[model samples]
Target: MNARTADAPAANPTSAPAGTLLHELSSSPIAESLRRELLKRWPSTPDRVREISRYALLAPGKTLRPLLLVASADAVGGSYDGVLPAAMAVEYLHVATLIHDDVIDDDELRRGQRSVHAHYGMADAIVTGDFLILTMFTSLAECVERGVPAAAVLEAVRVLAEAGADVCRGQTKEAELTSDPSSPIADYETVISLKTGALFRGVCRAGAILGGAGPDHTEAVTRFAEHLGLAFQMYDDLLPYLWEPGTTGKPNTSDAGNLRPTFPVLLGYESAGRGDRERFTEALSGRIPAAEAYERLRELLESTGALHRARARAETEAALAREQLAGLPSSEGVGLLAAVAELSINRDR
Candidate 1:
């Protein structure tokens, strides 16, 4: 599925294409309600923080995290009426990360537009990110007002708060690994798990808790989310090699420019001969221009079969994600979750 903002309804979900399925899921009444609540909770204001936040929150992209939260709740027989605030909370947390991440990575674009830092200056972006971080907790707290147990809301807060900390540690670890080009595949796995998988697992587990699911089902969904997140990050690393910025919605050279040791680059380097290794190291160190590094890495990744290997790993993770679904009862939400697993590896943007 592509990361298009506009949501469309599906006439026949069973027979619809993957993109349509995504649009259908995103346009569901519950999802619409979440959108309304988001707009209502954070209405237009003259304050710069509020203005920037409104832009960031309503940006053109797939609302995947919140959708996952709500869908997980539905899968376990929970109604949206009780889970909307929590869903909003996850999305706020996600956008906050994106804002801070753009600044840290020096990325100029996000969701097909100028990144928060690039468009709004670094100081404002940082402050806006902090505001959103605090806002996420308050949003989660509103779950109790919607009839969710205070205990469940508190637990969800703990889960997401830890997940946020994990993201920071992962970012730190990634920065450290950049100096060691030969960091093992296991290290890459660990980084992505903490950076990407942690929040995914948090949202799914929190959703299960809000839905009143038993421990077994909650564990299963958490595992599913973790594996899916890993696959998502793997595929995300491949997009620059497979498509242009116009298609991917972000600059294709951001990873190379930032000297990120993405999975594809690492795999290609590991399988490469001495000559290829030197070239890759030079490209990684920004000795070459970003566009050149991007092209060179793509060629090397293709030649060394690293691209194929990375894809295979993503497929394996997607399969693992699907396997966890068996623990949950059959429902529309479960089916949507399975489709999301499929989307992780197959998405173009």
Candidate 2:
């Protein structure tokens, strides 16, 4: 491990009580309500499939995407009942991505437990992910039954479809970049935007649409969520170095183990001088022991100031996200979303 930067600001930003609020938002009445609805609406047959799918879906999580969807609706004066199904739809899609991501990365842990693939084998995990994808659309269809207009449901479907495809594209690009670990920062930005930002924009846009927002407000929240997504991923990349497996709920070295070119890796390589640059290459290419490589890379990331630079960029993106919130109407929902933008940069996990 590297020494903590004495000059760095406290890890948790003062602008938002991110960790506490995440717990509050996840366990709030709305979240519990979603849980009940999920169990109620879940398919009843094929006991094994239902059981396996529930393992991941019902697992404890921040449920950030669902909260974002619900908050966007509330910001526009929309009711929870009308948007409940869309909330489910987004969570379904989110969980599927997590499961598939773990499979691809060969990660064993998720949310502090054995990952779906590690627990159930690859075949079951793959099919369970597909089942969740099908359920995302089925949940969308339920929105119509909940009194959302058919056209609105259709539009939400279209938005989520595009977002899902973009995530695939982003993952593909990320895999390609692993071969060229020193890829420029701009290319990394493109990948995160497609992978993470697209879904954030889609859910917020769909929530705005279903909540009766006009063109301008929809655009504003979409922009807000996109920036928030960018900052979220930046902070996420910092987590492995900043926190441990117990705190992050996943192996800290998973990214390095898989040879994934994460933000910190790229930034450090760019900023390092001759000696540190050569060491960074050794770590990335596995020329050294796993434990040594992990520690050396962390030290290099800190010494080269890559960690500081990444924190600054995350703060900038969070600020940009908050700026877009001004374009939205004032409400408690907007406040929650604004806090979320702060949380994007401030969170520890």
Candidate 3:
């Protein structure tokens, strides 16, 4: 990670002369709206918790999960306004998990800045995370008030709760695995899928439900979200090794101290390198055939073939997601969904 200016904006694909998957999905209005909403619900009970919550929630991030919710809603031709609460809820839930995750990982930094625990102390960070988790439920209650249908709200809550549990499980597994140096790649991936993919799946499911899709559509969206989430995490796995200063918003060698089960470390330098290439090739080779943007995504992954295998797995999942959406009505939101799938796998930061 490179030292970036404190107020520097997250890397944008075009402005930075780097290609990231999120470029096509960027929506300032949507992101701003989400921030405002999250701020409105910042912990108000305890002043200390409020401050801690603000620091964590207001941190710089791409807001990918919310974007996914909004895009998924759009894919079904639903109004963004209608889905805003759910989107916010998903983001809040995600932030809550991050707060807890930082504590568990004992990570000192996040998004190139001190993590909540580092800035506010561990006890306060835990309280802050708990507050955020409860606030997410409150947000969900508000969704019910907004006429999103009780069932839909409940479904989202259920997915979120299950995901939360899965994340905890993943964390436990990781803790055990990391203690021993012999953790297998498959084991690492399993933890990632549960820890990371679960929330992503929830994001998609919430969107599909809010969009008023049928059972089949919901199932398909779930599949798409699961694969997309896996891809997203796979990309994240690569970041710890490949991150650059000013580009990744953190120290280039930040993960070196952690000694976690990252792709490069697990596969070793040579085999990991070859795996990335082969995975990307398989990902785009009709294994999970997608539509128009698939080729563009494939090209992007291939170009960055240094991490091709991880990228390819992500692409394959995105491809599967695209296929899941095929039967749904075509709309601009759908296009956004497709773009988001590409973005999740191809982002540089």
Candidate 4:
């Protein structure tokens, strides 16, 4: 909500279209495939557990991680059959993370509906998330049954396990920052690199390995994922500050409400003039009431050019991600992957 600066580009209609296409691609095949895989390999007997598991698992998530995994396989001329189990496993893993995230954030809504924890109670939600993670490993085991080599499957398992560890570390660091708001910029980067970027890099690497990609192509996809993940998460952090809460399908004030130091807030802090910085810090410390605090943040971001600079950083990451696609062969698969990088910056929600 800055003054319409010449530096700020108009909302891109093309980016929305790319998002739409990506949405369509993420659903249909991935959803149907995952549904079958989960049903086949589901490891629950309690009727209630099954019901809540389906409730959380079948929610309208983007399935972006699975899209990358399956699409990477396609890009290498590998049949979906070889990677279908791994693809389903990645989808389950991502959904598991979302359920746990909502609980950690104490978020009320997800995908425009009541969050699993909100509707089902905390214990049930926790169990549901754990079940999904359990099923993820089961699905990974099925990958070998689907003709994936044992060595490749083992490596993919190692990558995913490491990423899971990284996510936990990231969350721990984020907690530390939330409690003490003076965290450095480098701390934010490290937290994000583990929490968000690790999964992106791991899944893409897992996909490439499953697809039998050469070492060079696998490395290329890894870099592509790293760039895209940082930009995607930063854009997510910017959404509440830039647009309405409903626009992003979550509570807008959650970060400020929790006093979390997001990238934009931290950037705004660095860029603000001395007086504005003091005012912003007081706002963060809750000297200002909630509603007034948002106003102050908006003013600081606008006058100090922090939001614009954050947007520019995200665009740079997207550009770098697109460049990584050059190492892959030309195909519709590669094109959609490239379009995803474009969609990352253009996305409004």
User: Against the true structure, what is each candidate's TM-score?
Assistant: 0.93, 0.91, 0.78, 0.88
Q: TM-score rank, highest first?
A: 1, 2, 4, 3
lDDT of 4 by residue, 1-349 (tens): 0111122111122455545745544544544565566566555556887778777766665666876787676565555777878877887777778889899989898877889999999999999888878887877887888888899899899988788878888888888887333568889988999899988888888988888888888888889899988988888788887777766778887777667778888888877678877877876786666677777777777887888888899988988887887757536456556766777777654
Native RMSD of candidate 3 (Å): 10.5
In candidate 2, which residue pairs clash? none
TM match of model 4 to true structure: 0.88
Tell me the alpha-carbon RMSD of every candidate: 3.8, 6.7, 10.5, 6.9
Q: At residue 162, what lDDT does model 2 achieve?
A: 96
Candidate 3: stretches off by over 4 Å: 1-24, 39-46, 179-182, 251-254, 269-306
Q: Which regions in candidate 2 have their CA more than 4 angstroms from the true location? A: 1-18, 39-46
Best by the TM-score measure: 1
Model 1 alpha-carbon drift over 4 Å, by segment: 1-21
- Per residue, candidate 3 scores C-alpha lDDT tens digits across 195-229 of 88888888888887887778887787788887777
Alpha-carbon shift of residue 234 in model 1 (angstroms): 0.7
Give the distance in Å from residue 128's predicted Cα in candidate 4 to where it truly belongs: 1.5
List ranges where model 4 is wrong by over 4 Å: 1-46, 179-182, 286-289
Winner by lDDT: 1
**Model 1 Cα lDDT, one tens digit per residue, 1-349:** 1122333232112333446655665676656666776778778899899999998998877778887887788677776778888888899999999999999988888888899999999999999999999999988988999899999888889989999999999989888877355789899999999999888988888998898788888888898899999999999898888878977878999888888889988998898999999888888887888899888878889999999999899988988888887757636667668777877777656
Over 214-327, each residue of candidate 2 has an lDDT whose tens digit, in order, gives 889888889988999899998899998988898888998887776666787889888777788778777778556666767877898889899999999999998888788775
Clashes of each: 0, 0, 12, 0
